[model samples]
Target: MLVKTFRGAFVCTALGLALGVLYGGWTALGVVAILAVLEISLSFDNAVVNAGVLKKMNAFWQRIFLTAGVLIAVFGMRLAFPVVIVAITARLNPYDAVHLALTDKDRYQQLVTDAHPAIAAFGGMFLLMIFLDFIFEERDVQWLRRIEQPLARLGKVDMLSVCIALVVLLVTSFTFATHAHQEGGVHADKGQTVLVAGIAGLITYMIVGGLSGFFEDRLDDEEEREQEAEEAAARTGRSRSAVVLAGRAAFFMFLYLEVLDASFSFDGVIGAFAITNDIVLMALGLGIGAVYVRSLTVYLVRQGTLDDYVYLEHGAHYAIGALAVILMVTIQYEINEVITGLVGVVLIGWSFWSSVRRNQALTAAEPDSEAAARVSVP
Candidate 1:
């Protein structure tokens, strides 16, 4: 289990060490260790949600996530993403941005930091939608039943989650604007930035989510899919409809996962600045942590942990809601990263323990002792 679950983690640690050794020797290694821990703590909820999405994907796409997807997650999102943000915000070309990262590290960090409002708006809104969607879903088992059931009922309203997200955003923007005005500050630009970034996030969620849901609907009718598969087998001597639809579903699912991962990374990237502006060191450490998260995701998927611990997803969505609120709050006042991490950890841990208790009750109530013994402890 260790080898299977943690192969990616091992590879990432080795690579992190090599990168540290080449960059700053033993001191760099220590920095790498710190950053990795920071990322893992910040993004544990992300791993749980990732597993939920990954379970829908086919084996080929799953492998791609572990391989090519890792490159994209680490290099594309962690390293290049910061550079690209700096480039766009600072109005410098990508090459110049790289030079700035290496040479004028302070300037690069400041550029990224300055762009935090928009980034926060976009990421916070996107993640907020994830939580709202989950809470609004009709589920058989409820982790926070009293809170969730009402929200699920509220979900019947058209575009309810979007409406709620927009309302929260507008309220926050006004608070920021009012605070800015009292301090003799400008309001139009800040409010506009918030609105625009939020709309962009909403559009992104719509597009990716729409495509994913479309494919999912197509693949969900088991009878229809099997019949189509059989018809294709008889006519073309190849049962391809189910396979094709399933692959299409997995493709959209993969895209959604990557975008979701990016949204979750926004706060982490910004928080890393609090530690160091050395982009390479930050990437090395965070990259290692990301690999472990991905490994944990795979472990959850393969072990069917989500099925066993039904409320795990509930915990993750709750954490996401908290993170979204924290992101928006950071737009006005500085929030401690430790506080943010602790809230998510606490929510998830509590939910996990809740799941354990529920499992114990169900196991005890089972008529067959052998059947109870067969149940896995997630």
Candidate 2:
């Protein structure tokens, strides 16, 4: 499993090194290595959350995730996305954006950074929705019982997450519109750009989720399910395929995965600018790390790790919440990527420890609890 999980990551590293050397020199290899580590640390929680979605997909879509999805994640978001954003923000042609990135890297990165508020608002709101929806779900196994239970109850309200997100955006964009701090003489303003971007993000979440849900439900309707059940019975639980190979459902799931990847990349892209404004280097470095993250997501799904660690999703969502707020705050200030990475690591680590303790308690109590039950029955 270790070899299987890391094989792609190793390959990506080798490519990164080769590309690094070609792009610059031996020193570029070191930069790529650092950026990969930074991206991995910051996105560990993303892998966990992705597993929750990916497991529902069949083997074919899973393969696509490794193959096609990797392309979207690495190049689509890590490379082309920044270029596209620069083009849109600066009103430059896509060709000029790429040219600017390749030649005048500093100006390109500045343009990207100058678009941070809108980027932050969009990504932050989407991620906040993910976090809110998770925490508000009425699950039997609660992590922060006191707080989670109330949030769960509040989940009964329709669009609750959207309301909360909009409220926060309104306050941030208005309250700090003029007072936005300066970075390298660039002002962070919360105006139409931020609001429009945020709403766009919110709408994106709804549309993606709705489309995926529609297809998923149609695929699992009662009649088709019974047919599947009958087929399974005839073949000892091995059912026939039905457009399941990158099917409609899988297609929507692909879109969802891409959007999710974009959200996660939003922070990494902007943050990478702070470290190194070179788009080529950022793409190579972060792209390597992004592949490893996808690898980790697949590993978690195959291993059923989420089932073993019940609170793991909880921790990941919490990390997302923290990241969402931090992303928003970062629009007006510079935050160390190390701090961002550390916060996620802490939450995930603490949840892992809690899972270990829970398992131990269950194991320790089994014998005594069974004995007591037997005695009572007699």
Candidate 3:
């Protein structure tokens, strides 16, 4: 099972390393390996969150995610995104931006760093919305009962998540973003930029997520109608299978996943400069890491890992909430990537341990319950 799941990841890793060596010999190879590890460590929770969404999609769409989606992630986000950011932030043409990225990597890196405030604000708020919506909605399984129970109850209030998110955006924009701008002495209207970017993030989440849910409901209704039609056909001795394509529902979900991935990649993209500024190397390394993440997501879904470990989703969301907070703080402060990665690992590890304990307790109780039932029967 492991081999079957990770086969593509292994292949990608080999090709990435080979490309790294061809690009700049042994030094580049080492950088590529480190970057790949860094991406995986930082994005483990992203895989979990993705699994939760991907499992709901059909096989054909899943293939699309693994294929076309990989191209977008590797090239579009890892390569083209930073170039576009540099182009916009530095007020350069697309050709010059590409040239700068290739010829003057230091300047390229600096411009991307200058653009960090808006990037952090946008990605932070989008991730915050994801975390907020998850925590607010009531679920049958609660990971942190003491906290989740109260939040779930409060979730009954209309638009509570949105309200809280807006408040956070406002406070951070006025305080951290303003302070960062003054400190950096670059953009005088940094606070305003942050505000607008954050709002754009919020609206993007609403439109993409809202459309996905809307179409999902439509798909469900259609499936129910199809099921009824099939039953009627069976009763009339003309039974036929009903095939419901994922259609628009899957498309929106795919779009949502890509946006979610881009948000998750923002930090990694910036942080990769700490290792090297070669955009090609960054794409190769991060691309390899992304393949492994996609593989892990597929593994989780196929193995029913989320179903078996009920609180895994809870932990992933909690980690996402922590990341969202970290991103917001990073608007003004420089946080260690090590710290960011550790937070996610620790949260997910803790949740997995809790799940195992719960399973053990249930297993232990089953025998006693069976014995009691036997005695009562007598």
Candidate 4:
């Protein structure tokens, strides 16, 4: 099962390494390997979150995710997106941006770094909304009951997540973002830039997430109607099932997933400069890591890992929340990518351990409960 799931990842890793060696010998190979590990560490929680969404998608859409979605992730987000950012921020044309990336790698990296505030704000808010919406929504399996219960109760208030997110944006825009600009001697209104970018992130999330939910709800309604019809036919000696996701619903869900991936990749793209300024190497390395992440998502869905370890999703979201906080902090201060990666690993590890303990307790109680039932019968 593992081999079947991860076959593509292994192939991609070999190709990426070979390209690395051809590009710059052993040193580039090492950098490529480090960048690949960096992406995996930064995005392990992304696989968990993605599994939750991908499981809902149909098989055809899943294939699209692995195929076209991978192209978009690798070239669009990892490569083209940075070029676009540099183009816009540095006021260069797309060709010039690409030229700059190819020839003047250091200048390209600095331009990308200069764009970090807006990028961080946008990605940070988008991820924060994801974390907020997850925590605020009520779920049957509560990982941290004491905290989640209260938040879920408050979630009954409409748009509570949006409200809280707006407040956070406002506070940070005026405080951290503003302070950073003043301290750095940047002449522009950094606070305004952060505010606009944050709002854009918030609105992007609302529109994409909202439309996806709307289409998904429509699909659910269709499924319910079809199930009723199937039941009626069953009474008349027939059985039928319908595809739940199709047409508009599947498209929107695909869009949602792509947007989510872009948001998750923002930090990793910026952090990659810390390792190396070679755009080709970064794309190769991070692309390989993304393949593995997608494979892991498939593995989780096929194996029912999320169903078995209920708290794993919760842990992933908490890690996302931590990352959101880290991104926001990074607007004013530098954060080591190692710290970001470790934070996610620790949270996910803790959740996995907790899930194991819960499963063991449940298993141990089963025989005792059966014995007690037998005693009562006697």
How far out, in Å, is residue 249 in model 3?
1.1
Among all windows of 10 consecutive residues in model 3, the one with the lowest summed lDDT is 179-188
Residue 35 lDDT in model 3? Answer: 94
TM values, all candidates: 0.91, 0.92, 0.96, 0.96
Candidate 3, after superposition: displacement of residue 183 in Å? 14
Query: Which regions of candidate 4 are displaced past 4 Å?
Result: 179-186, 236-245
Residue 310 error for model 2, in Å?
A: 0.5
The Cα error of candidate 3 at residue 353, in Å, is: 0.5
**Which predicted model would earn the best TM-score?**
3
Candidate number that wins on TM-score, 2 or 4: 4
Instruction: State the weakest 10-residue window (summed lDDT) of model 2.
Output: 237-246
Q: Evaluate model 4: give its TM-score.
A: 0.96
Please report how far candidate 1 places residue 314 from its true position, in Å: 0.2
lDDT against the true structure, per candidate, is 0.86, 0.84, 0.90, 0.90
Weakest ten-residue segment in model 1 by summed lDDT: 177-186
- Judged by whole-model lDDT over C-alpha atoms, candidate 2 comes out at 0.84
Q: Write the per-residue lDDT of candidate 2 for residues 1-378, one digit (tens) a residue.
A: 978877988998898889999988988888888888888988999999889889888887888898888888888888898998889877789999999998998788778877788898899889988888888789999877899999999999998988998998887677544465443355544566678888898899889978987887876784477776777777885555444423788789878887988898787877787678777788889988998998999999999999999889889989999999998787677788889888998999999899889999999999999999999994
lDDT of 3 by residue, 105-189 (tens): 9988888888888999999999999999999898999999999999999999999999999999999998998753432335467
User: Which residue runs of candidate 3 sit more than 4 Å off their true CA positions?
Assistant: 180-187, 240-245
Per-residue lDDT, model 4, residue 215, is: 91
lDDT: the better of candidates 1 and 4:
4
